[model samples]
Structures are given as structure tokens and as C-alpha cells.
Target: MESPGRLPYRRLMIYLDRLGYLLGLEGVALLRAFREDGSDRAFVEARIAEIRRLLDTPALAEAGGVTAEPGAVSMAEVYAAWAPHYDAGGNQMIDSEQPVVRSILDGLPVGVALDAACGTGRHTAYLAELGHQVIGIDRSPDMLAHARARLPGASLLEADLHRLPLPDDAVDTVVCALALVHVPDLARALAEFARVLRPGGHLVISDPHLLSAYLAPRKERTSADGRPALVADHHRPLSDYLAAALPLGFQVRRCAEPRRPALPLVAGTRPPESLPPHGAWDIMYWCPEAANAAMENTPVAVVWHFQLS
Candidate 1:
């Protein structure tokens, strides 16, 4: 039997193969590569070569190919494992999202600010530096502990974004950064943001871009009972945001989708023997050329600035 977190090699191989096809590799095109009399001899040869490698590689045949699929853990559970190194590790989504978010924040007049789902008080600290009286709220105690240490003087509460612990028309600015993708629905959290903001108060949000989320593999974790589980990360299309916000009387001030920084093509080298394929950037080892071609310059995150009207 497969171990709880051990994914099948076939699944991993299929994923890479699909990515290769999407990137115009592996004889996917009818006339150029798949046809017997096709002109692109190199393309046909490359696809056959890849197929043989996929079938025979020791790494692909190994017991745990990728982390196990699609199970879910609570936000609290997800952050419990991540809190210690949340800021230590670099995140591409955050890298692309922060500058746009800050640029929007910089233009807005600062006042009382609420940082909803404010993990580690990252933006809360920024809001404070901008002279806003900031209150930070998050659901995960593990993340809140880090936030408390980072902003000793600020009001930090254990709360959910769906039910922010603030009164109507309470603040002039609300910032929720890199948290909405974990939310099952954007409506309730957005409604909460709308409720707490005074008329014309600014709301800034940044989420993992839907395309980025779709392309990335689901994060794997262990459930409390030792079953395979996935960290909850949902892909909400850009239209979903508009539908939710427009109903709540928000006017779009600005929206930005920031592309990931370009990645250099990787050599045909294997990943470290110690790490799982799911380990950060390790899966690229399977088919580095196609991975590079498919992922380079893809949008990593979406940032929005809205004003309650």
C-alpha cells in the first residue's frame, strides 16, 4: 500500500507530461510532431526520448513521487506548520504582490487601519509606519504569536476574516494580504471589509493569482489522524472578486496582476536525493526545459484596491 503522503509515480509523470504538451513539447502538435511524416523530426524524437525516460527513471519509480493529493486541513493547521519559517522563506506570490500592494497603500490617506488575516503583522507594521492606528486580526494562534512579537504595541486579535472584530465604519483602510486564496468564498470576507470601512475607506487585497494557483501543485500535509491532506488553497477567478465586491458597493480603484520574476532554464540535473519532488522547485528536475518554458513570466499574484462608495 502507498504511504499516506506518498503519491504515485504515474500521477507525477502525467503532470510533467501535461505541462510539456502545454508548452508545445513532446509531439503534441498534429502536423509538426505527432504525424508520422511530420517535418519536425527533432520534436518527434524528443517526445519519444522523454517517454522512454518517464517510463524507466529510477526517481519516477521510487515509492513517493510527490506529496499525496487534495486532502484538506484547517487554516490553523496549515499555519501551525508554516509559522516558524513563514517570513524566513521567500514566497514568489508575496514577492510579486507586495510592491503593488504597498504602492496602493502609499497613495491612500492613512487613518485607522485594519489588517485582516494579518499573518505575522507584516502589513500591520507597514500601516503603523505610515501613521495609521493599526489593528491586526488572524485566525491562527501560531501566526498571531509571531504577529504579537513583531508588533508589541499594536492591537492583535485572534479572529477570522469572515467575522472581523470591528464595528461598522470603524476604519479608513483595510488590508488583507495573500490570504484570500485560502478562503472558500470571497463574499463574506469582502462583506466584512465593506462593513468596517467608513464610506470612501480604502480596501487593499492581494491573493495568489488564479492561474498561478491552477498551475502550482496542491500543497500536501498530514491530517490529525495521519491521513493525507492538502493545505487549503482555492483558485478564485478574477471575475469572482468583481462579482463579490461590486455587490458590496465597492468601486475598483486599481487592480494589478504581477508576473513572477523570470527563472533561468535549468540544466538536466537531478534534485537532491534527500528531498521529495514536491520540495520547493524540485519537480523542475523531471523536465527542466518544459517547466522553464511553461512557467517563466507567469503572473504570481493579483492585487486590488477598492473604495467603499
Candidate 2:
């Protein structure tokens, strides 16, 4: 057997690994909990309690468990259930795009651009104002409807990002803001992004960091009438995001962590009937600008951008 003095160190290392694993499962479980009933306060509280317990256990120091908390749901289910509310007041999350757009325009050559997951056209209209032909693509018709109304002149297409309708190397810039987290297969989505970008074109992407997923730092909430509300998810790490950009022939131009608003910018211009009593707020945006700029000089941010090889 190992010496008693070394036992604590060995146990501590085991505990740390277990804690990491538990946290990862908790991330997935949290996604499920929100989906089952976004407004289910009891359910969410129970999950929080369970996750806390797991984090506190002594054995967790030796080996972590990756079990889902009771009554957890999937991320896709959560998005689909929240789709209507998302379209109505969800633009608040996209408001983080203001800074992202500013960063991209400051560096990229103005031309045709695509808002890969345009949501409600928050960035679509802004890109148009920048004098670039903008095309917004989303999988939800309701989302596209709101996007179209907001950006009537800009082209809005209802399609999934994994399988885009655009030809390879057709656009000057591609902006994927806050959409990668929901994608089941992040690698596939990044491939699609590479496939559509023109040689030497620019691509900007933003998403929550994996570490942020565990340190939520806020109390979970529910509707007064008890409806499930959605929170953010970070399916992949910063390293994965960077790796996806390479091998597709795109060079890392700028990698910076862009800041986001404290609360999600609520969409005020939606039909009242489809709106939620309280909007989903507090989504983060990452603004990574990659160009064929030879990877030598790139503007980088703290919270949002990550430079790729």
C-alpha cells in the first residue's frame, strides 16, 4: 500500500479529477433540467442541491461520478421548447453583437457577410448598415420571421448551420455569434463554416467558455406561472474552437475575448402574444476574428477571442 503521507496527495489528485468529471456531467444535466420544465423551480433547486452534494463528497476527491442529476433533459429539447419565447424577446441575447460587430468591422474588409445563426437578425441589420450584403441563416422559421421583419432588405434563410445552402468560398466574412453551443456536433459545424468561407476570407465566432459553464455565479430562476427558462451552454472548450478553424485553410487573424452585457438585451419589438413574461437574458458573446491575415498580427480580447493556428 502507499505510505500514509502520500495517501492524501494521491487522494487529492483523484478528487480533483472526479470534481472535473462531475462538473462536466452537471453541465449536461443542467441543460436537461432547463428543458424538462424551464419554470420548474423545485426541479432546478433539486439539481443544484444534488450537484452541490456531489461536489462536497470526500470520495469525489478520489474519483468523480459523471451521472446526470435527477430529471435532467437534453439541450435540443430545451431550445425547441423555448423557441417561441426565444423569438419574441430573445433578441436581448443577440445585443451582445454590438461590440462583436464593431470588432469585426474594425478589422475585416467590408463586403458580403453571413450571420450563420442569425437568430432574430440582431447582427444582420447592423451588418447591412455597415454596407455589406448580409444573409442570415437559422433553423427556426419563427426566428427567421422575426429576423426578416427586423431586416427586410437583408436576405434571411431558414436552414441549419451544419448544412448551409451557400456555395463554398462565396462570402467575404462569416459571423457566428452565440450559436455554436447549441450545435450537437461542434466539429461538423466548424467544417461547414470553413466550407462556405472564400479563400483568405474572415470568420468571427463567439461562445461561452467551458469554465464559465461550471461557475454560473447566479441563482436559477423560474416563471411565476412555472415555465422552464433556458440558460447558456458551452459544449466545447476554447481549444476545440481554435482547432476547428485550422485544416480548412483559414488563418487565425485575431483572437480576443469580447465582453458581453450583464443581462440579455430583451427584444421589445415582438408580438405581445408570443412574448414571455420575463425574457431569457445574460448570454455571452465571443468575437474571434480569423482572416487570411497570415496569423502574425491579430487583435485579441480577454473573454471572447481565441487565436487558432
Candidate 3:
């Protein structure tokens, strides 16, 4: 009795596309009418009820996470509030990036090193452990508070990456990770890093890949009061970094672009393996299908190593 344009098969194909986009099993079970499988509608209903119950439970983080009133906040304020949960959340970058930085720094010389735009001193602490005089710099006082707590002995400063306070030739190495994506003027920041480093010093940077920018990347976190907060990031092509750094006396020595690891499958979704070999399956966002088709084979994060010339 249905019209040909609105036939079940055509409608089902469209639903399948939307269903698999960054959703978990609980989301699939909520739309009870779409259970074409006919295998077990009761199981679907039971799972949805269980999910609802779990959502009703109170979380301790909700009590302490949000502190400000219901209003807009700056990125600095967001990090200030997010410091408590910074390392505890689903940040896939910290895990994927540390190894890359460690691998590049393994055989390189270590002297006075700057953790440019250091957040919470994670890399700063690691650099100090490796026998470098580590100086951590960030613009946020609240973020610096957490960094200071973790690295009392290391010199921590409240400063902006755009204008590093140190004198020229002050350090032998600088590690700027995952922070460049937020900078509007990459050239100025790169110049500042170069200005402080002694000639031949190493500069390592890790940033979100350009594809994420093309797809419009956003950072989401819970405010101190448990409200959703979003931060925007700017993405530039990896080549742009190389171009901006070269004229500033940085000689590119190494580069790595690593894609995210595969994620778990959700209900009613085609197994990831069923997609075309080049189609993306790990990006945890919803981009237009055409964009996915074009970028599925590209990496999602980029790390670069440069030596000051």
C-alpha cells in the first residue's frame, strides 16, 4: 500500500546510514519501530529500559564538575574547569601522541626544554624525568595551578605561546604538542619557538590532522557544573606547518600522521569491515558521507620534528 518513492527498502537504507553514526547500542534499541529483525522485540525494549535506568543514576563528577553560572565561558575558563577531568576522560590524543614524542626524543639531545602551551604539565613532568630543565608555560592561571601541583620543582610560568618570555637561545629543545590547532597565527608562534631555541635545537609539534578541520572539529567537555561546553579548533594542512617553520630556520627531520584506532561496533550497523577498504570507520564524528568517502584513507593526527638551523 505504500508509495514507490517511500518504499520500506529505500527508507531502511537511509535509516541505516544515520543509525551507525557515532552511536552506541543503547541508541539503536530506543527506536523500537525500526527493529526489522523480528528476532526479539522484547530484548530491545528491555535493553532500552536498562539504559534509561543507568542514565537516571547520579554521578559524583556532576556534583563538582561545574562551578560557574549558566552562561558562556572562554577556552581558558573551560580548561580551568576541565583540569580535574583532563586526564580521566576519553581523550584519545594523549595516548596516541606521547609515544610519538618519546620516539622522536629518544636519541635527541636534552638540555633546557620548554613545554610550550603546556597543559597540566603532563609532558613537562616527563621531560624533567628525562633530565631536562623543564619550563612549563600556559596562559591560564587555573591550568597552571594543576601543572604546578604536579611539577613543583619544575619552573612553571603563566605566559602565552604567542609571546614566550624567555630570551633567545635560552633552551636546547621545545615540545609543543596538540596546542597549535588553537593558534590563529602559526607563523608567529613558530617564530617564537625558534627565537628561544639554540641553533640546532629540536622542536617537536603534534596537532590534529587537517581532515578533522575540514570536517569542522570541536572539543566537548562537561563544565564544572556538568553542563556541556564546546571549544573550537582551527586546522591547517601539514604542509602549512612545514612552510611556516622552514623560513624560520626549522629544518624538517621527521613527520608522522597516525589515524585513530578502530572503535567498537554498535547495534544495527554494518560491520566496519564491510565498508569499502578506503572508507573511514574510526572517525568519531558525523561528516557528510561524501567527505568520508574522500578522506577515509587519510590519517587523523599529525606529529612533526624539526631541528633549528
Best by lDDT: 1
- Candidate 1 clashes between residue pairs 3 or more apart in a chain or in different chains: 71-230
| TM-score sort, best first | 1, 3, 2
Off by over 4 Å in 3: 1-73, 215-232, 267-298
- Report the C-alpha lDDT of model 3 over 1-309, residue by residue, as the tens digit: 245776442122111122222233344334323544442666556555644543453431122222222223356877777788886856766766778988887767879999998998888888888889899999878878888989886799988889999999999989998898878689999999999999999999999888645432233344556655434445788778978999998998999987655433343333233222111334322222222332333466799999998
- Candidate 2 local lDDT, 1-309, one digit each (tens): 245656421132211233454354455545655654543666556556756865675654444322222113344444455665664544423444457656756666788888998877766777887888888998867677777777776788878888999998788778887778767577788788777777666777766545434433222233234433333333566677667666666576655554333332222222222212221112111100100111111112222332222
TM-score of each: 0.82, 0.55, 0.66
Query: In order, what lDDT does every prediction score?
Result: 0.74, 0.55, 0.67
Better of 2 and 3 by TM-score: 3
Can you give the lDDT of residue 197 in candidate 2? 76
Q: Which stretches of candidate 2 lie over 4 Å from their true place?
A: 1-97, 217-234, 259-309
lDDT of 1 by residue, 149-212 (tens): 9999789999888888889999999999989987876898899999999999999999888767
